[model samples]
Target: MSIRAARERGRRETFARLERKYRAGEYEEVEAEARALAAASRRHSRRRRPLPQWQARVLATGVAVAHGRGTEVLPELEALIDELEPVDPEAHVLRLIVRNNRVTVLNGQERYEDAETEALGILRDVTRLAHLTPLWRMELSALGALAVALCGQDRHEEAEAIARGNLPRAAEPALAGLHAVLVRSLNGQGRHEEALAEARRDPPHQDRRDSGLLDLVTAEALHGLGRRGEAEAAVRRALADCERHLHPAHPRIREARTLLGRVTGEGPGD
Candidate 1:
């Protein structure tokens, strides 16, 4: 098999094993395996004939994200991008993917401005592409990131506009995340009634993290509308759902806790 194919096979096998471990409730083992795979990939990349440079970096990035080391991988991804040949279309596509990953990392780190900047750059590059048919998925991904980053920055109106404009094209399962971004932007702007309405239109799948976020937005909107009883219940549900699915220190969990505190009149610190 070609180097790329071989690398792909390895990735698929590793992820399959990790998924099985996760399904079996072996989260600690899953995390350990993912971290080990990330380290192995990084070490392997130092070899003279390691998997293609971009492929190795992409593998490392995926592993970092899987292991909850998103922020830690940003510098490596950035350096990889700096070494790419910008004139090559393949390189350009890889750059977009890396930048999208960077946006994700920055967002997770709560660096909204940096995420917004990187996302905007990705969007601009997407526009410059002569043919977007092959890049449609990445384009939508960038747009989703841009919307989320805008919401993070409290530029809700702009975020809402972007999400609304792209919602139609986001019919695919992979693109459904745009809906969450839209709902979040609406909630951030204090459009409580509208946010609640949108959150219900096409609620996120129960198995997805977005579902927990949707609950959080619902809680926030209900609270803003002075429905304290409903808000408290919703916030508690959000907290429970997030705590069950996300890391203890994840930003989403922290936000849910803060919201619950507000709804319960206990303050976030308490």
Candidate 2:
């Protein structure tokens, strides 16, 4: 192989390994590993090798997010996105990824209008670049982010329409997020029965992250239906699952706690 091809292969392999570790919930480990890689890449850039720095930055940003650093990373990601011009296919794809990351962080920070606007822009680009088959997954991810943003803003009907239209086509990795949006949006619209029915249609999720999210929405639907005891039970389970599986600072953990308070009527809001 050419020298450039060999270097690219090595980088791709390293990134794939990091991706696997991140998915397995080894957040601290991934952070350390990615940081080390980023440092090395920076050194290479100084020597005129100019390795792709965005990959490391994206991984590190993901780690920060797991630790509930949405507010911290928001501006950094924006700056990085600005630095990345769509001058070529590689740069274009990297910019899209960073933009999507920004949208996700905005949603986590409860800046729903901004997230919605960013996601809409991302969707426009993804559609315009539809010839890139690999971008299909990014398109789904952006759509999911947009749906969540809409739900956050209480635009339930629009969110529900987006979820329902996309859920059937979502890949396995994107299923839980889109499903959560759908359930939450239904509950927002006061369609508790329909929301509960839809929640039940999902097979039991083995991953705690997925289960915890579904549990939260189920609790909301149950609470709306005046099933107080059941709602409390579901919310408590959701809180436990989130506490066990998510980062201490994860927005979902806070969300579960808030819902718990509402269900019990003994915590902060109540």
Candidate 3:
């Protein structure tokens, strides 16, 4: 079978097992395994060539690096980029994604300048893709901010602009996770009120666990708003949910707890 076909089959089998777990396995363990499978599936999709194939590769590599998939993702990215490097920079989608993926992956791994350049290149290409949707536009902006952040530029302002621009539309769509990232960008800029407003406007929910980042942003905004008690509660809930749904050592989980402790001076169990 083709690589794509194989991945698809693996995913189908994994999810079939997942369904059985959902039906009979222990709740917490099954949920945890399901989340892992979902992450792996996303990584698989990102690496496989399909629509916007390059971007998918980059995104997949980024997640892989962020989750410490390490050499498994980066080498593949480099090889793919090499194949597409001769293509027009604007249309060489695979190359562009590989470049950007390099940036996100390296940046996550603390290889700053390299990552920044790759990310910027991807952003430039994304901007030039005249045929973009509102969804893609927001994603491009957010990715632009990520590149800028890696480059150590004034990224928060840009991130906030992109996030805010897309925030209103988010409520109607299922972009709570994107909105949550914007909330962090807002909070980073001390736009606490706007961040709080955004959080209130889109409260976290049970099924929205992918948006665990939302909890961190909301908690921080609340703490800044002098709603420490509420912030603490939100942190506890977010942390608990994240622990339940994600790998224990996820950096986002560490970040959430760190911010929570800084704000409330209390642990999750406190």
Candidate 4:
């Protein structure tokens, strides 16, 4: 095979390994590996040439955000967005994905209005790419983030409307996340019964990660309804699922623990 073909094969293999490590909740290791890959790829290319492998750099940025370094990574994400701007057909979708990550980071930082604005733009951009089936995931993700931003701003009713309106179109993998948002929106409105009912209406979850979130939300709804025993059970299930599927320090685990404390009249530190 030609040198170019061999290099492409090696790049794909490296990316596959990085993705697996990222998914396994090894963020620190994945971040280090991705950064090393990006630096090496850039050095291998001529000084004025674009890095032969952009995905590694993007992955590193994402891993940084995952590490709760959102403030630190925002500038990097912006630079990546500029670098990834449509030099190729695939680059546009990747650019939008990076933008989505920025919105997520802003939301994580509680910058609701900023996240809302970013998510709206992403929605418009992704809608224009609807012809590409794979790109539809970006649209769903942006919608989810928009709902979250609205919730953050205490606009729960609007969040509920958006989530309910999009439920039918949310692919199976995204259904549980949207449903979790819908439940939180309902709980925010003090509609505990509705929230509990909504949680029960969830389609079967294929991934434990998704079900764990629903469990946490279901506990909240139950707590709001004065079902302390049920709430404790749900929160315990959520804690177990999250502990197994998520990073040790993931926010979901902390949220579940806090709710458990509420249910049992014990402090979160316990």
Candidate 5:
């Protein structure tokens, strides 16, 4: 199978196992299983042909990120970019993917300024290729990352505008993530009603982690709107879902727990 196909298949299989574990109430095993899957994916190498060497490395970088080794992957990704042949169009495309992933890693790390700068640079470069079909997905990825970084910087209005403007009409996973970012930006701006509306929109998929995040955003929006009872319930559900699927120490779990506390008129907890 091609690298992308292999990666997708691995992810689906891993998520299926995770769901089984979750349904069996084996929450403690979920994180370890996820990490193991990521490690195994990184170790499963295919011959480099239909996919370029850099493309394979990008896939490996994604595995590293899944294993929470993004910091370690970034320098290596940079080195790969530096080694790329200048005139190679395929290399250029892979470079854009690498750069976009770098911004994503930075955003996850909460390095807002750095992410913002990198995302902007990506946007500039992508604009030149905006009309090209192959680069369109990368453009969308960069836009989503830029919106997220803007939210991290507390620039809620701009983030919301960008996210809303760029949101795809199709029910693609990437668009779902962008919609979540839009919901977060709305919540940050105290537009609770709007945030809830956005959250209520159809999601791209039923992925547990994404669903949990959507619930968390919904809970915060409800809380901001003074619907304490509903907020608490939403947050509780978010906490349960997230804890079942994510690492115990995952930031999303902590955020959900903190929101639950606030909704209950208590300070942040757990």
Candidate 6:
């Protein structure tokens, strides 16, 4: 098998094991194994991607997720900036993109403040790339998404400035999707009313019935607006849809059940 394929398989197994432990109520074991896997991946990636530091940083995430520490991969993420700097001028900054989703997940799982603070620092420095690379447009779009993560952490003023200052050349409407996430970030910070207003501003791009992830986010936004009844209904609908339409092992389904438990005040394992 290819190296990528082998690495991917390891990650898939880790997620499956994590789900089983979550159901079994094994939280301590869950946290430990997650930490170990993350550590090992960092060591492996360092040796593998010595030049482009971003790729090395991104590799650790795959390792973290594979070991079921997907929710707490920040220490590894901190290495992104070092890789981004004059550390390697030849690095493909635009292609160092998947890390964007790791930042996005950090916002969702309650690490918003940390994710936001760090991402802004990167935006400030990536200006170095804006005038030099052929993929300025792609990198700009990525920076916009990262800005969204920062914004959703209740850094609206910062998020707006980050997006406006850097997004003039981006092709994708990444900021629009981020606005949806901001709805939750605001809700987390006791800005529920504002979050509700933003949630209503656009038809969400992530409302597909077959994807539990979209449903969970929609449910959280709804729940935040004192629409708990609708959130419950949405979670049930997502679970039903996935059980019927998607693979039983799909990641979205696992996340939906976890979020549903949090929303309904009863764990899905019940």
Q: Which candidate wins on lDDT?
A: 2
- Model 4 is weakest, by summed lDDT over 10 consecutive residues, at 202-211
Mark the regions of model 4 whose C-alpha exceeds 4 Å error after superposition: 13-32, 47-52, 63-75, 86-88, 129-134, 202-211, 240-249, 264-270
Question: Which of candidates 4 and 6 is the stronger one according to TM-score?
Answer: 4
Per-residue lDDT of model 4, residues 1-270, tens digit only: 999899889888988988888756677888898888888877787745354457787888877765556667899999888878665557777788789889877876778999999999988777777776457767888898899899999999999998999988887556767888999999999999999998897445644335378888899999999998999999999999877765564556777888899888896532
Better of 2 and 3 by lDDT: 2
Estimate every model's Cα lDDT from 0 to 1.
0.72, 0.82, 0.58, 0.80, 0.71, 0.54
Better of 5 and 6 by lDDT: 5
Ranking by lDDT: 2, 4, 1, 5, 3, 6
**TM-scores for every candidate against the unseen true structure:** 0.76, 0.91, 0.59, 0.79, 0.72, 0.48
Off by over 4 Å in 5: 1-52, 66-72, 130-133, 168-171, 206-211, 247-250, 265-270
Off by over 4 Å in 2: 46-51, 204-211, 267-270
Q: What digit string (tens of lDDT, one per residue) describes model 6 on residues 136-202?
A: 5445545655655665455666655554465344333344444444554555556667655665664
- Model 2 lDDT vs. the true structure? 0.82
Q: Which of 1 and 4 is ahead in TM-score?
A: 4
Worst 10 residues of 6 by lDDT: 204-213
lDDT per residue as tens, model 2, 107-209: 8889999999999999998887777546878898899999999999889999999998998898765788888889999999999999999989954344433
Question: Which clashing pairs does model 1 show?
Answer: none
lDDT of each residue in 1-270, candidate 5, tens digit only: 899899778666756766576545454365455455545544664643223334445655644444345676779768766765535566667677778878877886789899999888878877775555356667777888888899999999999888877775424546767888899999998889989998997755644435487788888899889998988889999888877665554557667767877888688632
Q: List the residue pairs that clash in candidate 2.
A: none
In candidate 1, position 9 carries an lDDT of: 90
Which residue runs does candidate 6 get wrong by more than 4 Å?
A: 1-88, 92-109, 134-176, 185-214, 237-270
Backbone clash total for model 4 is 0
Give stretches of model 1 more than 4 Å off.
1-57, 66-68, 83-87, 130-133, 172-174, 206-211, 268-270
